[model samples]
Target: MSEKRIEELRRQIQYYRDAYYQENQSLISDYDYDLLERELKSLELAHGVAEGSPTVLVGGKASEVFAPVKHLTPMMSLDNAFSEEEFLAWSQRAGGGPFLCEPKIDGLALSITYENGVLVKAATRGDGETGEDVTQNVLTIQGVPHRLSGSNHPAVIEIRGEVYFPLKAFEKLNADLVAAGKPPFANPRNSASGSLRQKDPAVTASRPLRMLVHGFGSFEGLNTQSEVYQLLESWGLPTTKQFAVAQDATSAYKFITQLSQKRHDLEHEIDGVVVKVDELSRQRELGATSRAPRWAIAYKYPPEQVNTKLLDIKVSIGRTGRATPFAVLAPVKVAGSEVEFATLHNQDQVRAKGILIGDTVVLRKAGDVIPEILGPVVALRNGSEREFVMPTHCPECSFELAPAQEGDVDLRCPNAESCPAQLRERIAYIGSRAALDIEALGYVSATALTQPLEPSQPPVQSEADLFDLTLEKLLPIRAYVLDPDTGLPKHDADGNPKIVDFFRKKDGSPAEVALKLLANLEEAKTRELWKILTSLSIRHVGPVAARALCNEFGSIEKILQASEDELSQVDGVGPTLASSIKDWYQESWHQRIIERWKASGVQLEIPDFAGPVLTDGIFSGMTIVVTGSMQSMTREDAEAKIIAQGGKASSSVSKKTSFVVAGPGAGSKLAKAEELGIEVIDEATFIARLAS
Candidate 1:
């Protein structure tokens, strides 16, 4: 193959890949794409073509389950330069001029193809050179546009983007999983990958996965870095918001530094910055290494690590009763803050890293957010180092720990009702915004309030006791009271509290203020049954689940008296949650607490739903699916409309779907709707239907 022909073929193949992967609309069918690829391979074989050959693979094989294929161009890993010194060295080697510094998204890399402005194919990075054809999955991502907006468009375009799960979505997903008696995912990266690799495209579509275009895999007409990014944005593709034209490496480093500080506030995760030569001509002039383009380099942020001693390893019981181990370390500075503890993740992680008590471990904070133990210093281990063991019983309640059922790794405490740790967590959760929505009783305060006094001399043993305690009793000498005016604590000349600090108030005086606060709490008991029940902190019951229970049972007293079978009958309340709730209410101590609260004049009334209910509508009893970008309103707003019209807004498209509301760049959901023979309506049609 001639050099010109090889370049043309490479460009065409790249364009097709982008169409299929980055864009949801396919201009050419799979057959045509395959034919083009085969022809390119044939041409390369015919001519001993080495430079710019379409046959130069970059991605890996598609599994048989996925149909594995290797990349023509080896998808080489970037040599990360973390500091200015390292970047300067890289730039010196490349003889740098102007560069483009872009945000480094923490996501899975993918390649996409576009033909005549229509999306056609999408694939993962896989092994870099060859990747699984994930066109179906890519279509589900919110950022990939189905069709370009402008009439004049590129003949073929290939783009690359990082697909990620947003932090909010990840947290919500994990919360839902925990509510269902399943383990939560550790982080968004793993969740994103797992969601994308699902066999069912519909399943992947349900996850809040987003895509951000970062670079061009192949392009026919685009010449400059700015032009490519602008073209992507014009096509409704999500591109990295942070991009700057730097005249030199120093400017590029400055841009990177500014972005690094703002990284923590971004909705999506970013690890570092990517600096590329701005001018396409200059990029070509400074051309390729055998691995990476000489005009481009990734400048990663230094790993924020701190040296801290492992004071102890303790097991924490989660909302699901699963016990997770974490390390309590001596306070050490890392990532601009003092960190005294880090998650051990799991037994597997602990064993893998050979972490032990008394071992000096390296704690790393990524993006100045999550702190995790890197590993122990093997050479520094001494005779004092002790192997940590997971307890067979709950440390709080002494209940036997049971192995999680199939598909779970953690052990769980069976004693849900009597476990102080479980009860405390439950109460804290209830006080959370997602639960009882209690504004006054925060997690820390709730924890302190719920804690039983000394076993030998029990104080405030029941909920009624809380109402009887004086303000002096509740206040601790060290607790600071926020001054309503300044939002800070009021201090005396010596920097002590003007009024004794809550902690200090306990110094041999009856807590009159605590008693008054207890009285206020007693008055609030009548506020709503849902608030009362939720605030009690039953296991596996979140705010939604609590509301569901309230909707089923009329009041808190009714829910408390309900049997496991009766509680399980409520919609969204499963056997596990039912058992947990039942066990909690059935306990003598818990019953005593409730009785005391009742005696203290705490009312348990159900709050009325404020929203108007649709008695009759086309949407009533219908399940609707919303997909892609809506111009008139946000996706959330559209979903709210569906719910308001008495329709059930489902995350994924299924056979039961009544209709699919699609918008610009509607992806996998649209395809799934077509496959399932479900009716698909555009934003206008959806609005019209809702009106009708």
Candidate 2:
């Protein structure tokens, strides 16, 4: 079990690493990725470690498009500390000291070499040992000096620095890209990386790129890291003025805290603070690890909150027909990603947050979690800001909207089966990784099939019609790629909707996406019964409940026939889920969907060799709730381990919950557990309990 989990973690980490380093894309935020790697490192320490484990790896392989250059000295990555305790622990390990603390610039690392006071070559920090030679592109950056000043430099020196896009420039660049009908880059770091790696030096030169010296590889003259920076500045190279030599760990931490407070004021993004032993002799004495220097560690700040104009408040219809209000904001960067829309949950939440249209709102995004509207900057509001009004009718279908139950905060559209917006979301959900995992049937494909721009009749009106689609049916499909959160068409600079012939080329031939989707639909029919159940969009019935139901009943027919009491008897399927499943199946439209899917040859029975049933184990009948950031494992992995031990991993805290595993940053759930007098344990205690 440990081996299986370790392999899974390794695979996940490798995928993200490759995306960030090779593809110049950030699939997840830095903090979330760090948590995953931390979990993997912890797991490897407990269970045997692998040779190629990401925990022991540094950066990624150099791109084949560029010539590889071996570094004079390896450019290792830095281990991260998310909390002060962790930072202090590193300081203790380094034998306490006056340390140099500098902002950990969120950018691409570059190693520039100078021979006889003349800038010669620049390369990326690819896999630490070898890098992609990008001398031409690096020379294009404004702050990178072509030649040293005053000529007192070493005969040969390798300067390590970060190549970054200034915040203002990044914003303008994104605007320019949007104006040119091109997709904007995700963040400044990715934009900088993509610009630096451009094959054409002219293209790189056109971008607003800058550099900041952070360290050096083969500088014989420098006695300390701080001296290296001063020397770099003297040589007409750019260096950060933010660096300081702190007398102790407390002072170092103080510096980090102060920097974090004004992080947004900086010209370039700084995700964390790098604290290192100031003296070169001590750095060597402390030595190094395979992946990072033991003398240095990065203290990462929590997710950032930024202010953006709340252009308007709009409602988005979900797969469950729930009408959720979201804030349409002037796009802004937050937590290393561009955030334009943030969910306000429902009407009550909008009122609670005191957010008004045209007001400056505080937006917070943590890791890859969805952006959240914390509240309005009430002080910044002018007379122009207006209150949001919830619509009486469904925006998509023009059907009357009402709460599912009396006094409920949320409103829902009753036209669930045929509402284009709801159907689009449901079809897209079916293709999500948690459901059927159909790669080709994404949000764009879902919208094209259900709500085409050149609409006569859409190719698909319901998910039931999804499998029946043919090339002829899909050939005429055209749609604008609508923003999933706002349901508004994306437009070009001239304010025209960007219509895509989703299933065909401009020349009218069937496109690759169309053929792939058809093949995927056929393949989806044979997926495990759990996936089919999950794809049904049944209220409150997700992967866990679906798997439990399939394991107990084996077939969808048996589940359909089962009473609510019988359904609730399955592990992880409580009365609420059972009722929801029962209510869902009783709808005529849902029944038709099932019948159509059955006729379409979808396997609705559990496979014969469906792995272990997991009916009994150490934690049998116990409902465990794990919350916050666990140091030893991710919440998902923790839940999986709990389930493997015959426990029901629940999301909420209630009277029936056996206990709660609380870690750092545990919030409302921990409070609820304490209020309910339920037993609570730390992650370490919980892990030990699992072992016992």
lDDT of 1 by residue, 275-341 (tens): 8877787776886745457778877665454456898888877655778788888877656677767
Measured by TM-score, how close is model 1 to the native structure?
A: 0.49
- Cα shift from native, residue 660, model 2 (Å): 7.4
> Model 2 over residues 345-408: C-alpha lDDT tens digits?
8887676555679977657675545797755544444699887999999999999999988998
Give the winner by lDDT: 2
TM-score per model over all chains: 0.49, 0.55
Question: For model 2, what is the C-alpha lDDT against the true structure?
Answer: 0.84
Model 2 bad stretches (over 4 Å): 1-303, 607-647, 653-692
**How many pairs collide in each candidate, listed in order?**
64, 0
